[model samples]
Target: MRLIKVDHIINFKLLGHGDDPLDTKKCHIDLNALRAREDAAIRRAEIEAERIGAGVTTEAQSIFDALSKTLPVRWESTVIVVLNEVRVSSPYKPENVVGGAGAANERVKKVLELERKRMQHGRQ
Candidate 1:
């Protein structure tokens, strides 16, 4: 991938060796641009890792993933919101789930219990 700086925007182009004879012969590579891109990517990865490590347990994340399959899920600080109505707080137990319509609340509780059992049994 070749990164081109055009004004303030960065553009990427995929070039194959020997595809463009003239361009290949010229062989004008931007080492600075490549280095900048690499540095930016590394910084982004570090930031993402830090965000994921911020008190979100694997159990809580797994529960959120499962619930998101059939419902709208979002994070409210350390809490997981389901269907925009139900809130599942940390320690993510059935009892920790609160505030939702009747059916949605029941579904969230069932998911929490099922996830808990799955984790306890070490099942994927």
Candidate 2:
């Protein structure tokens, strides 16, 4: 079995490298999207910090290797690194709401209509 080094990826999704129809490469590789996924990985690592010490592992990777490793899970809560930044979901009402999802131009609505017709044989 050989592992191919992939570089091209898009939208947090991996596209595959070979002509084979059943390729695991497509589903497994998400290198370009890792930055967006870093927050979740960090949060997961934080939660599992204790496991690093008492974990049962005979063949442990290097310190740097483990540090660079990303968690296979995602985080729900948004973790902000900058100070003086309030959370957007804070319902307590803030002094100012600037440059946020709510403040942005969000006008994406859906149009719905009925496809049914022929009401009682053309309303006879």
Candidate 3:
């Protein structure tokens, strides 16, 4: 097997040199990007709290709200990291997995739309 190293723009680093596609390897994480994500989550949560007239003054609550967004697609960047790994490790190369790289993005969009309709109808 050939060693493959990937340096993702989103700060994901994967170094795999094995035969098994599913075999995991050490991943180098970017502290700066992680911190930025945390900061963004908190900021968005605060904005949502204000919009919904909810009192979310603590960092913990803010982070929680941000993780559970009304439109989860806003957090889809995190999901992309996993999909990228799958693509990189796969033996067969297809133009795209599941109809294209935007498959997850489209799925997230559909989920958000469904959530909106559910909320509008006062359904869970």
Best by lDDT: 1
Which residue pairs collide, candidate 3? none
TM-score of each: 0.57, 0.16, 0.26
lDDT of 1 by residue, 24-66 (tens): 7778889999999999999999855533424788877788777
Question: How well does candidate 2 match the true structure in TM-score terms?
Answer: 0.16
CA RMSD of each candidate after superposition? 13.7, 23.2, 23.6
- lDDT (0 to 1) per candidate: 0.81, 0.31, 0.40
Candidate 3 C-alpha lDDT tens digits along 14-66: 79765765545745679999999999999999866443312333332332233
* Model 1 lDDT, residue 29, Cα: 84
Name the lDDT of candidate 3.
0.40
Model 3 lDDT-worst window of ten: 86-95
lDDT of 2 by residue, 1-124 (tens): 8655566433365687668866787567677688769988998988766334233222222221222242121111421111123222111112222233442212100000010122224446
Task: Determine the C-alpha RMSD for candidate 3 after optimal superposition of all C-alphas.
Answer: 23.6
